[model samples]
Structures are given as C-alpha cells and as structure tokens.
Target chain A: MLSKPNVEVSNKSMLGRLFRKNNKNIIGIFTVVLALLFISPYIYIVLTSIKPSSDAISSSPTFFPRQLSLENYVTMFNQMPIIRYFLNSFTTASISTILAVFLGALAAYGLSRFSSKTGHAFLLLTLCVRMIPMISIAIPMYIIINVMGLIDTRIALIITYTAINVPFSIWLMIGFFNNIPKEFDEAARIDGCNVFSAFIKVILPVSLPGLATAAIFCFMLAWNDFLFALLLTSTNAKTATVGISEFLTAYNLDLGPMTAAAVSFSLPIMVFSILVQRYIVSGMTLGAVKE
Target chain B: MTKESRVSIYFFAPAGIFMLIFLFFPVALLIRDSFFEIDMIGQGRGAFVGLSHYVDAIRSERFIGATTNTIIYVVVAVGFELILGLFFALLLNTAFKGHGIVRTIMLAPLMIAPLVSGLIWRFMLNNQFGIVNKLLYDFNITSSRHAIQWLSDERFSLFSTIIADIWLTTPFMMLVLLAGLQGISPTLYESSQIDGANKIQTFLYVTLPSLFPVMIVAVLIRTVDAARTFDIVWVLTQGGPSNSSEVLSTYMYKTLTRYGQVGESSAMAVMFILLLLAISSYFLFVMFKANKK
Candidate 1:
C-alpha cells in the first residue's frame, strides 16, 4: 500500500493525493505497532523463561536475554510433576474430543436428517447451553462427582469436558451436514442401507474436513479449560493448567521457573493450534451460516 | 416407533443421556442445594432454609461489590475489544501482503490456554520488575523510583485484569468480525462509490449493517465468556486489593472452595445463572430477530 504510485505534481490535486498517500502510510505503521503489542507478551515470557538466572531477575529490565539457558525449564521439570500434568491433560483432552465428536455427530445427524419441529427446538435449547457458564454448574458438579466416587479422576474431567463441548460440536456438525445433499441420504436408503450405516459409509467419509475441524476445536476447548480442572481434580488427576497455577500459589519464588513452566505448559497446544488454525475459521464460523 | 424415529432416538441417546446425567442433573441439584444448609465435607443436608441464602447473598457487601466489578470489567473489556477488533478487521480486510503472518501472530493468544495468558499478564503487571512499569519509566510516564500498582492497588487491579483479558480475547472478536467483514460483497462498495459515498458514509450505510449479525454473534460470545471470567482474576489479584476486583466467578469459587459456604455459594450460583440466562435470552432474541430480517 505504501508502495503505491507517487503523486504527480499538479496544482489542483497535489494536496488531496498527498493526504491519501500519508493516510495509507499511517495505517501501515499502525498495523505493525498493533501486531507488536499483541505479540510482545509471549516473546517476553519466552525470553524470561530461558534467560540466565542472573539476568532473569535483574532490577534492570532487558528486552532480550543476554545468556540463553535451559536452567529454569530443568528446574521446573525436576521440581514439579509437569510430565504427569501434561499426560493427564493430553489424555483427558483427547478422550473428550473423541467422545464429543462422536456423540455430537450422532445428535446432529438426528436433528439434521430427521428435521422435526421437536428436533429444531432441541437444537435451539442446546444452543442455550453454550450460554450457561461453567462456574454456575460447578458447585453441584463438584458434589456430584464426589457422590459418584469419581472425584480426582481423569474420567471425571473427560466426562465434564465432553458434556460441555458437545453442544458446540453438535452445532458445528449441523452446519456441516446441512451443506451435504439430502439426496445422498436418499441414495443410501435406495441402496438398502440403514440410517446408521448410511451415515457411517456415506456422510461420514465426506465430512472429514468438518470432523477434523470440530475435533480440533473440542480438543482445544478441553485442553485450555482450567476452572473444571481446578474444581474437579485432586492431586492424581491435576492437569498442566492447574500445575502451572500451583507454581504461582505454592512455588511463588523465582519467576524464572514459573515462566518456564508457563511456556512449556502452553507450547504443545500453541503449536498444535498454529498448525490447525486454518480449520478454526471453518469450524467456528457456523454462527455466520446459521438460520 | 417408526424406523426413522427409532434411528433418531438411537443416534441422540449418548449425548442426550450425558447432558441429562451430568449437566441437567447437576443443575437440579444446585437448585436444591441452595435451599438447604449442606455439610461442607460430605455435603449432607442440614436444615431447609428457604430464600434466606439468596437474601443474604443479595444483601452481602462482597457479593454486591463483585457484581459491580463484574459489570465494569465486562463492559469496559468487551466494549474496547469490539472497537479495536473492528478497527483491526478493517485493516486486515485491506488484503495487504504478509497480513497472513500478522493474522497468525494476532491470534496466537487465543490458541494458548487463557490461564497461561492470565499468568503471563500477572508477570507483566508486576510493579517492581514488570515490562509495563519499565516501559512507563522509559517514556517518562513514571519515575525510576516509582511504579504504578498494576495489580496491587485497588484502583488499577480490575483495570489490569481487563487489559489482560483484552490481550487474550480481542483476537477472537477480530477474527469473527473479519469473517463478517469478508463476507460482504465488493460490489456493495462499488455501488456506494458509484453513488458518491465517502469512506465515513460508506462505512455507516454499507459496512455496519452488513456486519451486524457477526457483530451480534461476537458480542454474545464475548459477553457471556466475560461474565464468567475466572482465570485472569484468580491469577492476577485473586479478586484482591481487598475485594475490589472480585468478579462473580472468583467470588463464587472463593465462597465455596475457601469459605466452604455451600448453601450461600449455590445461591450465588443460582443468581449468576439467572442473570446470565436473562441477558443471553435477550441477545438470542435479537439474533433470531436479525435473522428474520
């Protein structure tokens, strides 16, 4: 934009052209500054995580760390059950994604293919579930999990995560399935396949991109959850999110290891998201495609 | 039952059962628990106290403060995010080269756990050694010997949390609005130009109306999420500086987890749900109304 053709020297239009050129330059500069504002904290955290101990806590702040080292990360690994937390988070997140996607696909198929007024109402009511804050349901959930003797278990977290994410998954699937021709379902029926087999052998295969998108989203939502993990789990099932939170309350000493822990906690999911962000656009924009 | 209805029933069974068991049953229990004084340990029932817990929470200073703080936080944060998101969406819609990299960087915060960003914000808001303070001093916004209490002082703690939240969620608003922006046809702009419309008029008459649904969707999502804000408040101040920054989520959490007030916390939860439900219903109505139009 800044490389646009230069203004020709003409008396009548010189000022207007100059003003337009300057406005473009202003927008270009503003865009870069805004990007830096958004990106700087992550960079700062990463740098602080790896900075040598001497410079990490130095009274004078430095933009870039002088001596890069892995000391803080080493300490975080040794001192905390970071690996266990990661394992728990990963296991629960994956299980929840699979469960949510499967169950949501089923419900969405029922709603989309059946197309009853009752099904429409059910879908609308489920949309309301997205508005129900997790914290509101948490008090009873805590007691309910305890009542069932499922407290401090990854399955508890997985069940809760799946339950919460299912509504979203269902909505996304409805959007995806709506686009698929109903004639395909008819074609399968004409071939003598039942509804279940028709979905499995026909619709399911073609909706891979949509499934991948929804699955990735469910995984992300479950992985990033902290409130559920906090309220639901005890020591055995604590997630990486709660593990990092404890470093604040329990290990409140040096910021180095905490930052290191924070970085490492977020690194895998961050990289995962960056790789799959293209899918996020399709997965989440169902709001734009809705009735 | 007919074959199709049976198939529908079979397909819906897993999710329907799961929600009824986990989500709805728990909600029923929450409503019941609010009327009883329950044991902290076993959660055994005590005495039936009808509407007393609700009354007390309604009258409580802490709850009132938390409600006030939540309103301020949600209003300021979501309002700012909308304006800034629309601004950036407009910028992104320029189709400039390398904007893809910028878009990825802008959205990096959304991918990571919001809890981590809350922690990072806490680190950045440290008065003594934080970059925020350092930058302030660099620009002579403060003295080397003095720093603003970004999270420590009562005046700035909630504001600090809002800034962190803005950092975390604005990308989401931007992406949603950008999707909305991109959905508008270029022919609309050409028609507006053909009619001698300027930038301001084109934006007011053409862009805003077209983006309304997306804007409504973005607002609905952000507002509900903002109302339930926990991670940032917990990490930053724990609703601290003497409860000045306490949001409903942190208040409800601390009430149950710290004070062990199950009955009252359940009441608080009830109130929180109703409030959100009422507000969200209004938004949902608007959404469906817009869709009809």
Candidate 2:
C-alpha cells in the first residue's frame, strides 16, 4: 500500500511539472525583454542611419524606416575628412596598444614573479595613478606637449595615451601572469632558457588572452578619447571621436550624417566586443574575486 | 642583490620611467604651479601667489556648485545603477536558452565610446523628434506630444544625465555581478531549500553574504568611474541649463582652458586629486582584502 502511494506521488509531481511553467522560463522571458530595452537605442541609431534626412527628425519618429538610403553615409564621406580622422585614430590606438602592452607586460612579469617590496609598492602606486581623472592632468599635459612642440601631431597623442594606458595594462597583465603556473618558469630555466627568452617563448604564449584584453582596452582608450584630442590637437591630428564631436557642434545640424558617423564609429568596436565577450568579462573582473 | 633579483629591476625600468616622467611629474608640476599665478597671454607662470589662488578656488561659487552637483550625481547614479543592476543580474542568472546572446547584447552599449553614447542619447532625447517622448505619448505615460525637456530644464538636466550614465554603466555592474552569481555553488541553494528556509531567507543568509565582497568591488568600480564622469555630461548638457549639472572635471576644464585661470585651476585640480585619492584608496583596500579572503 505504501509503495503504491509513493508511485502515485512521483506521477503527480511529473504531471505538475508538465502543466506548469518553470522558474527558469519566466526568468528567460524577463532577460530577453530587458535585453531588448537596453539595446533599443542602438536599434534606433541603426534605423536612423539608413533613413533620409527629412524623415529622421520628423514630428512623429518612425519605429521602422519607411525608406532606406545611403545618402548620409555618402555625405559623411564626401564632406568630412573621415579617412584622415580614421587613420589618426587607428595609428594612435594601434601604436599605443603595442607599446603599452610590451612595456606593461615586462613590468607585470617582474611584479608577478619577483614580488619584491619595491615592486608591490610600485604596483600600488600605479593603481593610485590610474584613479586620478584625466582632466586633473590635462592642463599640465597640454603645457608639457606645447613646450615640447608636439601639439597638433599624432606622435603627441600616441605618447600621452601610451602613458595613460600603461599603468592599468600592467595591473591587468599581472593578474593573468599570476594565473600561470610558476613551474613553467622553473622548467624553462632548467631547459637553459634565460628570463627574457622564457618570457618570450613560454609565459607569453599563455598570456595571449591577457595581452589581447589589455590591447583592446588601450585601443578603446585612445579611440574614444576626446578631451586630450580637443585640448591638445587642433585640426591636423584630430581623431575620429574628436571629428564627430566637432561635427555635431558646427552650425550645420545635419542629423543624418551625424547618426551615420556615430554608427560607423561604433561598428568596429561592437564587432570586436561580440567576438570576445568572454575575455572582456574576465578582463574587467580580474583581481576582484579570488577566482 | 642576487643576479636574478637585479635583472628584475631592468624589467620595471621602462614602465616606471614612463610613468614618472609623463604621469607623475605633470601632476607634481601642476601642484607646484598652483602657488604661482599664470600670465595666460604670455603662456607662462608670472608670480608666486602663495595660497591666494587656493583661497580664491574655495571662495568661488562655481566651484562649490560643481562639487555639490558632482556629489549628487555620483551618489544618485551609483545608487540607481546598483539597484537596477542587481535586479537584472538576478533575473538573468539562469541556464536558459538564448542566455549567451542576451548577455552579449547587454554589453554592446559598453563597447561604444562614451562620447558617442552621449551623442546617441542626445539624439534620442531630443525635445521635438525624440522617440522616447513618442513612446511615452503612445503608451499614455505623458499627456501631450510635447517632448520632455531633458536637456533644457535645470530641474531635469542632471537627472537626464544620470539616466544616460546608468544606461551605459549598468551593464558593467550586471556583468560583474553575474560573474559573482555564477561563481556561487548550486549546492548552497539546494541545502538552503532542504533546511526549510524560504526564498527571501536564502537570498539574505546565503546569496547576499556570499556576494558581498563582489558587490563591494563592483560598487567601487562604478564609484570610481561615476566620480570621474566628464564626457557624457559635457555632450548631454554641457553641465548646463545654468551649471546645474557641472561636475568638477568640466568646471576644471572651463576654468583652465576657456577662462585662462591656470593658477586657480591648478588648485582645483589639487583638491580634485585629493578627492579621487581618498575614494580610490578605499577601492584598493577592499580589493586587497577580497583577494586575501
């Protein structure tokens, strides 16, 4: 009799589960809805980019574009020296990333492996340096650059951005370096590898993900910068970000080209972000938890 | 020192030299310059003004206004982000289908440049043609088609900037919190359930305490970012509708570059650095503690 009751209970639980939706499904629905809401602005921007100038700012904005055209993109290219700005941004970001990661990785290795009193002190100091707002140092930077006669040149931005990005890059790279087993270092030495060669051939290969993360961050810092570019560069070395900001403020209120410019500016980063979402999560939360 | 230990010094030299010459020296120079008044037209420091510029900065009404506005912005923005971020993180902490896609989409806004995000929000919140107002009207949330004056009104401008900041940064909080959430063992939840504890009790006793360290780290990150916010506020409202939204960075920028008051601006920069240092030390402290734990 007892066995029969237990079997009936199991069947009843199965029936209940079949009839009722689970908690996970409800959470999934909410997640989808929330994601849509968060992404709604980009959706609007994409739609606006394709719309005709006249239709973009109409009295009642269309949820979906009725007519699509590439006139804005054409105008963005035709009027602005967009390629020049693009080249400036690319040069600065790429150079900064390469140099910052190279130097930062060196510092990170010492800080991670050696762990000397001075190294930890320097590490703490780097953290403090990263916290100070860019604006706090902008005036001095401007004065320094002007004195050096490096203003209005990509070299000026490249140097300044490299300095700004290195500290945090070192911090990030150190976390990843710490993750790597010390046995590799000892093993490399046993194989007659010097510290530099071992770092090059052994430890660094594993730290590629960390390098990529630091590189992406440095690139974004350079790419997205406006204030330094605004204060430091006049016209010759203006980055794409500075170009877009100025394009907006000019007397001509061309909303369509502006959206087109914004869209183009965001597209590369978005593509890169989606491709490496996992690394970004790890990169951002590094040193936060024990894991 | 041993050869190995001495060789490590070479590795630190390149980064250390760059930071000392470029980053730290400028800041030190800025502090030293605060005592000297600058002749803006001559592009040179003119006279040693002692603490007069510091006194002037303290007495300036604009400085006071910017400080007050910044504090409010940081507190309110961080408050809203944490609440909304925690809520969304919990909602998505499931092994449901489409989770990866949804999570990826949530981080898309973060990849955009801060300045561009400001521009996008600026366009979206336009008084006449904004879709936000249209949606509100369509849903009967607003009584008229006249778009809300997000950027113009002094009362609403600061809040609007906060909303934009929240939109951009909430994903950061969510991602960090979600990582924390996923790290918790499922066995904890099962054991709690078996103990006859209710959902609220489980969350309070098990989930929250476990997540506390991560929460501190997340809040500190947001705090540091929000306290230094410049780009979005500048683009969104230029700290205006009458300086209602002026943060320290924008105010410092205007004082130094536009007004040519270098000495006073340096003093402002000094005070600003102190504030940042105080806040960041706490962040570092907590992070160190968390690591040790």
Candidate 3:
C-alpha cells in the first residue's frame, strides 16, 4: 500500500516535469517576441530610410519599404555639411579619448600603487566631479570658450571632452590596476626596470582590455554629446548630431533624408559597440560591483 | 616633497592640472556668475546681484514647473526602467535557445545616440504618418490614429519623452541586472531549493538580496543620468506644447541661450547641480550602507 502511493507520487511528478517543459517553451517564445518589440524601432528606421521619399511619408505608409533607393543618402550628403560634421566628430572624439586615457592611466597607477589617504580623497573627488550637472559648468564653459576665441573650434571640444572623460577613465583604470598583482611590479623592479619602464612595458600591455574599455566609453561620450556640440559649434565644427537636428527645422520635414542621416551617424558606433560588446557590461558596472 | 609624494605628484599632476583648469575653473566661474548680474550683449559681469537671481529662480513659475517636471521625469523614467529591466533580465536569465542573440539585439538601443533615438522616436510617434498610434488604433487600443498627440498635446508630451528614455536606457538596466544575476552564486539557489523554497521564495530571499548592491548602483547611476537629460527632450518636443516637457536642462538652455539671462540661468544651473548632488549623496549613502551588510 505504501509502495503504491509512492509510485503514484512519481507519476504525478513526471506530469509536473512535462508541464514545466512546455511552460519553459512558452516563456522562451514570449521573451523572443518582447525582444523583437524592443528592437522594432531600429528595424523601422532601416526600412524607412531605404524607402523612397514619396513612400516614406505617404498617407498610407507600408510597414515594409515599398521601394528601395539610396536617394535619401544622396540627398543627405548633397544638402548638408554632413561629411565635415562626421570628420569633426571623429577628430574630437578620438583625440579626447586618447588624451583622457593616457592621463587617466597615470593617475590611476598613482592612486592604485600609493594607497595614500590623499589618493582615496582624490578618488572620491572624481566621484563628486562625475555627479556635478553638466549644465552648471556648461554656461561658464561657453563664456570661457568665447573669451578665448575657441568657440566653434574642434580644439575647444577636444579639450572639454578630455576634461569630462578623464575622471571616468581614472576610476575605471584604477579598478583594473588594482586587480593586477603587486608581485608583477616587484618582479619588474628585481629586473632593474624602474617604475616608468615597468609601467610602460609590463603594466600597460596587461591593461589593454581595461584601456580599451575606458577609451570606448570616452569616445562614445564625446561622439554622442549633443549639448556641448550644439552650444559650442555652429558651421565649422558642428557634429553630425547637431547637423541632423537642423533637418527638423526645414520648412518641409523630410523623413527620408533625416532617417538616412541618423542611420549613417549611428551605424559606425553600432558596429563598434557590437564588436566590443563584451567589454561594455564590465565597463558599465566596474565601479559598482566588487570582484 | 618626499619621494612618495614626488611619485604621486608626477603621476597625478597632469590630470590634476587638466581638471583644475577646465573643470574646476569653469565651475568656479559658474558659481561666481550665479551671484553677479551679467549682460551678454555688453560683455560685462555687470553688478553684484547677490542672491536676487536665485530669488527670481525660486519664484519663477517656469523654473518651478521645469524643476517639478525634471523630478517627475527622473522618478517615472527610472522607476519604469528598473522594473522592466528587472523583468527582462529575469526572462533572459533562463536557459533558452538563441537567448544570446536576443540579448545582443536588445542592447542595440544602447549603442544608438540619445539624440538619434529621440529623432527615431519622434518619427515613430508622429501623429498622422507615425507607426505607434496607427498600431494602437489597429489594435483597438485607441479610438483613432490621432487620438494621442504625443508631441503636440501637453498631456502626453512629457510621457512621450519618458517612453523614449525607457526604450533607450532599459537595455542598460537589463544589462547591468543580468550581470548582477550572473554574478550570483548558484549555490544559493541550491540551498534555497534544499530548504523547500519555491521559485518566488527563492527569488525574493536569495536573488533579491544578492542583487541588491548591483541594483542600487545601477539605479543611482541612472538616476543622476536621467536627472541631467537634455538631448532627448530637446530633440523630441523642445519642451513644447507650452513647456509641458521642460526639464531643468532644457529650461536652463533656453534661459542662457535664447533668453540671454546668464545670471538667472547660472543660478538655476547651480540649483540643479545642488539637487543632483543631494540625490547622488543619498544614493551613495544607501549603497555604502548596503555594502556594509
């Protein structure tokens, strides 16, 4: 009688297992549907950008592109200084990233190795700097840029971006540097490699991933910034982001060209982001999470 | 200086100088300008205004409205992002086929510029030619295609920006939370199961506690970030339909740039900074306390 009851319980558990397997599949399908919904905007942009201008704005717009054309891209390039803006963005972002990473690496090394109370305080100061609203400093930055005759100059943007990025880079690199065993530094010292050469030859190569993460973040910030670019630049140094916003102001809003410009502006970074996608999560949460 | 001090100076000085000049100096100027009446046209820091500009800002209806909107935007947007992000993170945490690809695709929005996202959202949320309302109407969720004036109507304008933000940054929250979930030890789940805890009980007792620090940090970062949002709102509605969507950043932008009231704008910016600082410090304090546990 006890054995019979145990067998029945086993049978019931098997049914439960089957039910859960089906339930799991259902949840999987539901999640996939949700993911599609999340990315539909991107799909919409691509489809709309490829469509002819007439189809793009038709009263009865098709979900899919009725016809494909590069006419929008052609118009975007012809009508605007988009290429200049792209080049400007590239110049400022890259230079600032380089400057920020280099300077930040040095400071991070100092902070990591020294272990001084002052270093701790300085690290906290960076946190404070990060918290300060950009608007508060932006007005004065505008006035200073104007006074220095650096307004609408790529150099102005590069310097400003470098300053903004350095603190973040410092915090990120300090984490990486801290992770490196102190014995590595000691080994380098035993080989008669001084601090500078040891840092250059040993520390940096090992920190490549961390450096890349910092550089990527710094570059993204500088590249995607609209406020600084909008306020500081007019014609010569206007970024692609600022350039596209002007498209909206034109008498007849051209969805085709606008979407095309957006695609072009966003494509490079999207690709870059995916290529280095693994580093992003770590970069984002490094300061937050302990190992 | 001592040898250790010298080493510290050598390593840290360049970045320190950079910050002192470009960051600190501008901030100092900002604080100073907040106190003085400045004439943009005359190129003069005209008079010692003391706190009149601050007084004006405190009393100004537009300033007050923008501040309230900013708070609402930060709270609602971040609140929705946290919940949706947690939901998605949990969904993806389960073992499923092609989950990796789905996760990667979900992060696509994170790569796109906020400004571009705004533009894309604007296009998607457009009344007549837009897809959002059309889909709603087709699904019988709304009465007509133009029923929700996302940009033009004052009622939905702020929410429209919030929606775009949720779509844009929810991936970030998901990503961070997923990382947190992965960092959690499987042994905890095993122990909970051995203790006869159900799925919901396991999540509440084990998962939530383990994920607390990550969630706090993520929320703190997102809170500060959402507080200072500028580009999205600017691009989408320009705080339009009678300033319905005017956050502090856009309002400050208008005050300084369009209105040319440098002193008042400076005062407002200073106040905004103080508010952000207060919010961040509280978050930091909470995170610190959580870490102690």
Chain A fold similarity by TM-score, each prediction: 0.87, 0.91, 0.92
Ranking by lDDT: 3, 1, 2
Can you write out model 3's per-residue Cα lDDT over A172-265, one digit (the tens) per residue?
A: 8887898999899889989999888888989999999999999999999999999999999998999889998887753336777999999988
Using lDDT as the measure, the top candidate is: 3
Query: Could you say which candidate leads in TM-score?
Result: 3
TM-score, cand. 3: 0.95
Q: Candidate 2, residues B24-132: lDDT per residue as tens digits? A: 8999989998999886679877989899988988898999999998889899999999888888788778667788888888888777888887888888877777788
Give all TM-scores, in the order shown: 0.93, 0.95, 0.95
Top-DockQ structure, candidate number: 2
DockQ-based class of model 3:
medium
Q: Which stretches of candidate 3 lie over 4 Å from their true place?
A: A1-19, A116-119, A250-252
Query: What is candidate 1's CA lDDT for residue A50?
Result: 90
- CAPRI quality band, candidate 1: medium
lDDT of 1 at A47: 91
lDDT of 1 by residue, A1-291 (tens): 355354553533878778877777677677878898778999899999998755666667787988889988888888888999999999999999999999999888887777757556766766678777778878888888888899999999998999888877887787788789899999998999988899999999989888999899899888889998999897999998989887775324567788998988787767878888889866656665333
Tens-place lDDT digits, model 1, residues B1-293: 78887887888888889888988888899999999998788767999999999999999999999999999999999999999899988998876556788788887777877798898988787765677788888889788724788887998999999998898888888988898988888999999999999999999999999899889888988999899999888888999989989999999999989888889999999989899889888988998898899
Poorly placed runs, candidate 2 (over 4 Å): A1-6, A19-21, A116-119, A189-192, A250-252, B282-293
lDDT of 3 at A244: 88
Order of models, best TM-score first: 3, 2, 1
Stretches of candidate 1 off by over 4 Å are: A1-26, A116-119, A189-192, A249-252, A288-291, B287-293
